[model samples]
Target: MTTQQGTALTHALAEVPGPLPTSGVIHVATPHTSRFTIVGNHLAQHAELSLTAIGLGTHIQSLPTGSRIGIKSLAARFPEGETRIATALRELEAHGYLHRTRVRLANGRITTRTVFRNQPGPTGAPHPEPPTPTSAPAPAPAPAPAAAPAPAPAPTSAPVPAPAPTPGPAPTPPATRGSVPVPAPEPAPVPSASRPAPVPQTHPPAPAPSCPARKGPARLLPQPRELTAELRQTASMLLADLRRHAPELVLSEADIERLTPATATWLERDARPETIRQALTTDLPQPVKYPAKFVRHRLTVLLPPPLPGTEELPPDRPTLVIPMQNCEGCERGYRSRVPGHCRGCRAQLSAA
Candidate 1:
């Protein structure tokens, strides 16, 4: 091949336009760069072959394997919702381009990691999987209940197999064997006083008795007070509402401890659960940094004042004195003491 000419395999496709026709609203299939063209073809081969999968796959494959790919980040970047983004990621996993492995760190913590490749077949990859922690061995089985000792056999004598013949010949009659002569006997004297008395027996003294050690009553520590059923239910309902409004924020136990009192404050102000939910969620920022604080502040500030009771209403009072009709002498309002005159007019007439 000459220096000016390029081989077919290594050569880049050179396209030259020739008197082309015009078209209205053109769609660009591939990006300007060659790497992107490869990526586009990679996505086309695998994936659910849907627009969403293609978009997500293209976005993911553009970055290195160990990149932080959060659901919210993808949702914001693409026009699709969070649910659609999550589904597309799963679809990518179904294809060979994506691999997600759950790794356990040495610190006894576990996390999921994703590995991405534009092409398939990681058959001889050298990365070793995280070690699986060994679980504690089960406790040695309760010593099998000791078998009861076998009962001792009762003592028994063997019976003779055969009867024995009568000893020698039959015994002679008593009369033949009997008969004898009499003899004289002499008397013996009592023992002398000098004979020593039988010696007395002696036994060793008994050893001192032993006393067992005494044990005192065991002392126990006090247990923490448990939350009542009603309070727990209320807290769960409030937290559920909070989670719905702020999905990104996770409340710890300490956060719950701080939020419980705020919930109580809202409850005391005659605020319904739905009202409290709306008040806290009304104009929430896209991402709330401190959910617990924001919720508590809203609950504390949105309280309406208490209404008055029936006892505070006004009582009955006496009517003021006024004339029903105006008098000819003076036109004034007064209680109708005189038929057609004010009190002053009546008094003046009486004086005249």
Candidate 2:
């Protein structure tokens, strides 16, 4: 910090009226040297000692006067160890390094109480008497300069001619005797007024045409498909369709079983007969029962991407499921119905 800033900090510290708070310890990590300087300087000046005394004061007595005490004893005396430098200084102020006042009321009458220290002495040393001052003798002056001879004066010359002045109006003097008076001019003649001609009002130009609004593709709800003996084969076809057309919506082998019932129902209700038949045959089916339009809508609404890839197969795949087995709030398999407990068994649990 600049000297001016440091001085300002010191002034602010002095205005605080006491040492730093006990809790305001300077940490080893990211040490605040500026704050340390402010606190250390203030304590040193107020306690009438050096910075060393400020450090020593923390461990030994509340206030350390000189170098008579040992560090070991100082450390033992203060509970906070070496880091108690700030706390100790504050304790000293609290214990009377500076003055404090208190007001007390008894029988509705106020009484003032004052506390301070006026004398200064060594912490553990014997008291000494005040010293007297002695006056010093005056010094002698140096000798004067030597004498010199005089000389004759020279003759003076005549003055030169003054130059001619340039011509212009002379400045007028102020009207001292009375205020200056002036004549007023006559008013302008009024002219004959004429009626304004009628003019047709023009309408503002129409605004330019805007770009056509974009309409999102229609979202067809999934058709409800019948559960039959060919469920496994049908699921394989749906998986193939997802891979071929919407590879981004990757689902694992286990995910296929989990999603098949709902997907089949969706397809049966919404898809064409040919789309359903195609989805049932090939490993990589095209134009399958689950259309890209509907699948994209479902994925956008229900799942966050990037979706799981084909590499993450079957049992190891990340399942988009809410744990229902541990639920214990209601008889039904549903967990969403419970507000603050498991819906299945009515057991107290966290809200979803």
Candidate 3:
């Protein structure tokens, strides 16, 4: 873990006893990052690298020509646990730095093909811990061996008879008893609709009913609708100020309608207009790719935490689950952690 110890370890690995791989580090550039950066990032958390794994990687990269690496061989060379060495190799493969293929030898036996990649390799490489083949080659047929001896027969015995039941005397019946008489059936009554109505005298006309009671607006949600024209203009001005921070972002009418409620939320929390503006604009990078996302994260962070008690709504109120994204293909929505794609579309892509 110390500097001197790491240098000594590196030197020791450099003089490893047999033939080594002849691979060297190569730089590759992509739109996002290089292959080395990707691998390093996977190994490096918060810009700090794991010492043992990174050392193993450096050693693997410096291996000489025709040198093959395997879990068992690396385990023998490394003083650490075999499982740990295997895991590091797996990490290497996951980051596309290493690939392994199954090679059949001339002697009718198979071995591994260890391919060291300085940059990202092509897709569809075999697994590092390749599975044991469920269907193996058929074995050659052999001649039958000597047969076993037969068993001897036993002597026959006479069968036994089962016992019969004993006879019993019969008893006389009791004095004669008469059966009860059945009742006659009754007919069903006629329906009231089929009967005639009685004659009635004419009555005076009733006065017209009073006007029906006025009902409130049929809004789906009781959203705030009483904001004055002045407040709306102020909301528009605040949004315009947010736009100055990231001019690349464009807002639609619907987006404005949706965002006005957010500004209102900040105001209700007693956030000052200048403070809100700073929250939306302060420290923003130039040429922002996703202004909506930038503003969303800042707004969420600036939100005041809920009160200690009574933060939760009453149980009687129904919980509303808002979908984060809707599938472009199926048009169904889901509250997924990942953006843009739903479960169905993901599965559909895999199948395709």
Candidate 4:
């Protein structure tokens, strides 16, 4: 080609448009210089072109080359909503970037009768135009009558007849007591062959016999008072018996000494009668000594009735006897003294 012809062709191709081909497609030179005509040429060559192919992802493709596609088609392509593609199309049309056309298809033939675009059009090309404004007209005035008439005064007249009083009272009926109604007999239930036979009733499995009344008194037996001399004597006797039976219980000398005073105080003040009872009744046979600290502080003493033929008490089982002594360290026990440690040696202990 000649230099001028080649330059013209290059310029024409440079401004080639409607929309560029997809990234992978080749852009062929075309004789058209108009961007719209270039785009139409590309569209004709490709048969179909997506707005996305031209880097117009947001632009709607519902507008056909020569006809307007329905909103449903737009919705199907962009199911997300009009806000995405439809908005983009509206914006592009508003900014003169795109155009739309409305056409009708009849008898298998398509006809484009209207075109919508921001650009001015040639004779037959439809162009987008601003809507015309219409103002409302003033209302018509009311008509005047030809003549005026004078008003007349009103006059009083005869009174209306009072409505006739309701006719004479209806005839009175004799008072009679209603008869007592008889209850209807319930109908016998019909038996069905398909239904299972009813099982014979046996004396409702004689309500499992009630447990025998407890042998001892029903009400909880009153625990023996700890303060009484009798209760202390009983506890001492029990402790001695336990010790004699089970020597392995490891009642250290110190433990015994400490318990002796605590036992005395516990017996004197009647402290924890329940604990005393449990100690006596526990199944284990072990030496029982009143915690020493408690005995020193509270000084409880219990003296039970003397056993027959026993005066000084036998050596095998010595009775617990608490003697009053001067106060040593404050009489708090392990749990009460060092809550977070073992009181015996002041060693740290875990919280319960």
Ranking by TM-score: 1, 3, 2, 4
Best by TM-score: 1
Give the lowest summed-lDDT range of ten residues in model 4.
146-155
Off by over 4 Å in 3: 1-60, 63-232, 245-250, 305-352
Candidate 2 lands at a TM-score of 0.20
Cα lDDT of model 3 by residue, 1-352, tens digit: 6999989766766666555557974333235653342232233331232566566777786676476566678888878887788777666555445555554799989755565554333332333432212111111101111110010010011111121111111010011011011001111111111121110110111111112246665323112335556556666578766666556656656666656666666665556788788778777778777766666556655665434446566557687876577777787888865567678788989899
User: What tens-digit string does per-residue lDDT give for candidate 1 at 219-264?
Assistant: 2321114445565568556865576665754677777666665565
Q: Write one digit per residue (lDDT tens) for candidate 2, span 78-191.
A: 554654544443344343332223334777765322221222222222223311101101111011101100000100111111211111111111111111111111111100
For all predicted structures, in order, the TM-scores are 0.29, 0.20, 0.27, 0.16
Give candidate 1 regions above 4 Å deviation.
1-37, 40-42, 45-47, 121-352
Q: By TM-score, is 1 or 3 better?
A: 1
lDDT (C-alpha) at residue 80 in model 4: 50
Candidate 1: give the clashing pairs: 322-334, 322-335, 323-334, 323-335
RMSD of 2: 38.4
Poorest lDDT segment (10 consecutive residues) of candidate 3 = 147-156
What stretches of model 4 exceed 4 Å from their correct place?
A: 1-37, 40-66, 78-80, 97-114, 118-352
